[model samples]
Target: MEYPGGTREGGLPRVLSDPARLAALEASGMIGSAPEQVFDDLTRLAVSVTGAAISAITFVGETRTYWKSVPHLPYTGVENWQNGVGESFCYFAVGADGPFIVEDAAKDPRTAGHQAIGPWGVGAWAGFPIVTTDGHAIGTMCVIDAGPRQWKPQELETLAVLARAVGNEINLRISLSTAQRALSTAQSALAVSQDLARSLQDSLLPPVLRPVPGLDAAARYLPATGDVEVVGDFYDLFHTRGPWWTALMGDVCGKGTEAAKVTALARYTLRADAGDHLSPAEVLDRLNTAMLAQRAPRYLTAVQATFRATPAGAAGRLCLAGHPPALIRRAGGRVQQAGVPGSLLGIMPTIRLTDVRFRLAPGDLLFLYTDGACEARADPHSPLPHRPIFDEEALAQALADTHGLDAAATNTHIAEVLAGHHGGWASDDTALLSLRVPPNP
Candidate 1:
């Protein structure tokens, strides 16, 4: 069979034959793996976003293509679940090590005569490579349509993000397996486990907050001490569209892989819905629905703020579900609470979420955090029999004290205050996000 790009000669891409790439694929252990809920959730999400008839997580091997998860198609056995390497479009993504999209498979030169098109009834296809940490293309998270249709840019971008999520999941399992093996030779298995925990936790969150035009933003994540398991605290700040931006913080109910999966789903759903909805309540409502539909392993509480910079300052809506209220610092150094109390997510069929409108004048700032900040307590090892918790009143006082500080400074000061209370050993994971309007010249 002929390949698409000239990068390959007559047969498949050289990457398919590369020993290292093949080794990474084998180590993934997903070649003939049974269907799992996590992958199923992702494929379902892909279909929902792309409006496709079928969505799949496919891994291409040297001789065959394996379908790990296909929400529309049930898995019977390994022999019945795979096809020859040249029989599917998955190799196009693997060979090019990138996305392979075709609005019309029958007309596109790359896939005109593809063997799977007729049997699969694929009128259109869009796939993104699931690459490992070491840069090996393992498989793809793709959507397939029964009739020809043009895909939108946003839909494709979301697909790419989901593909990376699949890659992260695979790499996490690989890392855990390596850590388990290291237990025999390593002097301290605990240290190796902690490193693995931190890595997995980091993947669930954004490394740094993205800048929003006319708004000052800063964020920080503090992990609980002495815990080798991954926690579920996460925060993100991003632009939704022209002039609009969103900032959110959430804490899931459990730890380890279960909580991680829920966190990933929440973040992905939040991003996908935020673009279409302007109200924070609507965005989070959609998230709650998605969580329930996906059968999320853990329930979570989240606070989201969606706002756009105005000529006078910044104005937008803030919503909270089964979480603490958001704190706002006025230019006069007065700190006050915002957000209406509502239901937590993924626990019940019905929920009540309210979006409260808010505005920030020049020199004013808005702050969001997990319960860890206000619930902080002295180290358990301390001599004091009764430890005092850093309650909401104390948090408000700390925020008010940073009257003239910028967004970054405000977050730094609050983090320092929390550390002082906990003695640098937090009991629960803490996430902090702040957005401040610049003072007028």
Candidate 2:
């Protein structure tokens, strides 16, 4: 075949003037891009195979020859290995039909006066064209030595194979970049959806707890640890009417959207029925009825308490619905569990909860909590297959230890202890409500 740009005397190669080849090189989208590590690795491999002082993957562009990778080259305070198109040996290699080798650039007529010989100190050189799938040569994979050396035929073949491998790496990198961008776009969309779900879940619970006269009350609701998913644990303390105030805490079965729905339904029903002046047990029964009507595939355990002022102090009635027992800490540091037994709600049509009536003297504390507190592991970091449970016995001991602490301090202390026991992350959701009757004024 005839050459696009005719060869010079002694068959010295020149840049091709074929527009089709130039267009293919321009369409590759690799020119003037940031250097890639994959190309750097290929160049290093070429250096190892040829035992040369310098190895580079070069792209021959219209105006300049760019070194995509030159692993062993020292920094010269310049941008990169870039030179005028005709000044580098890669220019001739890109135009050659096959591998091009010059045993000594100083004596070879083809490269004797080349600019690469004087300042670059290139004595011996070997290069192979990096051809594209469409039969267009875009660049070269090259090795250079500072001293004259003859390249064996097998060495020439190895360089040819390395050149093809470099081509494959470039294509792989482009495909990988495209995939990473697509993954980033999908992750952004998922984050937006999770934020919306969290907001909606927050709206379903009480915004803030109101203070009740003559009582120091504090409550906490902790979601399950780790990923941000909607949990079913909730607590609220609000006044019904007149001198009566009601407080409720519950945990629904399951997680995510379905459990969240049941949690919202149960909270609204309890608040709506509080104004009827019903007993603590009656209110929970009403909640059970409403839950059964919805027929949601979830169940929950709950504790409800109604407080009213008495001559000696505040008196209250506690009702349990398949939930953990409430604890009563006397002014004298005696801890007693309410120990009311009942069945879970939402599962049975006619559910009944036991009501345990008790009076709180000045300096007395009433503590209500969910099963998460009892089932917590004693040593979360233990390597043993099973860890000890932080059951009611341990909890009662903790309460007894905090004898004279007020409502807020007591709750904070309990929370800290629970966090310590669980390695600062609760495996399940936790809810705690503390009600303290102040001393007589």
Candidate 3:
């Protein structure tokens, strides 16, 4: 192939036009193919993971880059989705047969003079090559930012992992095409997909609560048994600003990757807005607007509390968006509900959110949870004709029993209680967060 600027070293990288690589890509049947939901989900997950403006799966052919999925880009026709190979950053990953990263496209020497930098609005770019099982690099899975920023190591690693997942999906398709090996390969693919789902699901939630000065905080996420797909429950504890922090718990409707998209958006949006807005209601209200603007695929209910440590204990504002009211366990074991009920988010243009002020004196604790706690039901195989549900009253009693326990102990006790109620087989995803002010020392 001839280049307008003359061949730098026999034109573009040979891998972009490798005969064997092209054969593998053709065998995969992804080029110029109709959009697949799984590919789209991966793109969405890319955006969610990196908080990037755009994410895409592109096949770098001899002369054109064929887009298999671009979650944020407006879709046209298949012809419109393809562009000259020179018009994409994907070829960089394909050429390297590995990850291609540029923190600042316009300033990075490797891409400063690149033509795609201007048209594609490339600033910071990171991508990993999607390689076939037979060791042919076919394309790339990438994330794009409109402005320059450094990519984190973990973020790049995740892109690499997900790129492998894309490769696996493509190879799985090829394997299933063989009549004799279909059943055996299909079973293996299911196991790989389930394992990937679990990894991605864990990435969506915080592994450990960030320490809050003068307070003890703890959280847990319990996935339902017998379900391999990801669920929507999530929780977080982070500093909104100096001395002020936000604790949140939410449940998006439905399950699978669709719900994960919303869960990630809610969590990042809340963190982004909480620092600027002290009112829990104001921050949550802004999150609602962001969700609606993004056309979030699922609706979610959440409770947010923004508070700061005080000499007496902690003081904060709390709000609920169609979520179960938070339970407060007093120093002496009295349990009470907090927050005014309001509308859920992502479905309405106008929402009702009220910030109710509350204080956590020394030895008090605020417990936030998803409906899974209050609505937990007995095991499906229970012999009783009518199974018992661990309702709000029972939950309150459970919280009251943990009055003197610290945050970590409180979370553990509640999880145990819920597990016992459901016979170790919860039917819904559950998230629990607790913030406790230690007793005076």
Candidate 4:
């Protein structure tokens, strides 16, 4: 092939003039976006299937090959991984029609003098071009091995399949972005409200939970269907003073910025009060006082539980304010509800709150959730006059059936059940927290 502008002599691959390919890639709007877990997951799967030490999703630009995802490489201070167009195996793969495999770079004419061979120590490689819906090959899904090895036929097939899936995902993202842009112009006020709600909700919720001694904990927050604006459900698990830990789950009365303000106040106030070694009921009382002082047009329903290590296992004091009762699942598969009924917060100056104290034995589980879980409709799209709610009894039964599962597993199972009951769409936000007492030796 007679190269134009550049040739192999200068260690630069011939630059092909494919304007459509470059335009398609630019239109996808994915060149410099933040790395997403979905792409990293694909790269990880590629590494596992190909038995390669490193895997990456690479986009071949005009003068550089940008790595969309490199699972094993640390970001350090670098924002994105990029290499010269002539230096990467993906550069050649992007021009190829199908899977490109070099079993031994040192012995292969096409890759022996490649720039990546020396510094990156790439001895073997397999890459499949990621083709767009319009038939433009813009990038590649590739696997790299440090030592010489033979590429298996099955591995090549798997890489090709993953590449197609990546291409589809890129197309879907592009289409969704285009639609959102069009919608934003039409519904500017709604878009702004949604953005504000999402930002506020995210800021108020705990990003990560700190591990507590002798307890296994997990939590999840699911937004409602068509939830452009954020709902009021939130949960948190945090450590308190010596040997004390607290878990909170709550729901504010409304949606949007007003509800978000109340949510923030409730979470922070509870944390502040609990730090004084106050009981769960006392913390709620203080929070109620704070909410009333604000005089906001919103009410709050919540459950606050303080736990401490005990000789038997873990002891907890739970206080409820117009909130769903927490469920306890015993090691022997029995389920019971705990927490006293009380009036809603921020509604009245004088509120009567009750506390329920219980001890969790080894292998027992504690579950706290928002009302959305039990109130989820069994069939959201049903034409019948009435649709049954997946009530508390149903939730208790499900927990009893999943007796031996760990905290994370139990939460996942419950989410799946909720999805199934609601026909895969809930009308309201749902938050769940699960705590399990570790088995004693």
lDDT of candidate 1 over 77-158, digit per residue (tens):
8888988887878888888888988899998887888788998888999999999999999898889998889999999999
List runs of model 1 lying over 4 Å from the truth. 1-192
The candidate that wins on TM-score is 2
Q: How many pairs in model 2 have backbone atoms within 3 A of each other, for residues 3 or more apart or on separate chains, i.e. clashes?
A: 0
Each model's lDDT comes to 0.89, 0.81, 0.89, 0.84
Which of candidates 2 and 3 is the stronger one according to lDDT? 3
Give the better candidate number (1 or 2) by lDDT: 1
Q: Ranking by TM-score, best first?
A: 2, 3, 1, 4
Could you estimate the TM-score for every candidate? 0.58, 0.68, 0.59, 0.57
- The CA lDDT at 320 in model 1 is 96
Q: Residue 421 lDDT in model 2?
A: 80
In candidate 3, residue 3 scores what lDDT?
26
Per-residue CA lDDT of candidate 4, range 153-194, in tens?
A: 899888889999999999898788888988887698777777
Worst-scoring 10-residue span by lDDT in model 4 = 1-10
Better of 1 and 3 by TM-score: 3
Q: Is candidate 3 or candidate 4 better by TM-score?
A: 3
Model 1: how far residue 209 lies from native, Å:
1.3
Model 2 spans with C-alpha error above 4 angstroms: 1-30, 33-157, 167-207, 222-225, 379-387, 423-425
Q: Write the per-residue lDDT of candidate 2 for residues 59-156, one digit (tens) a residue.
A: 88766777777777654533566777767788777767578899999998878888778766799999998887667788899999998999988878
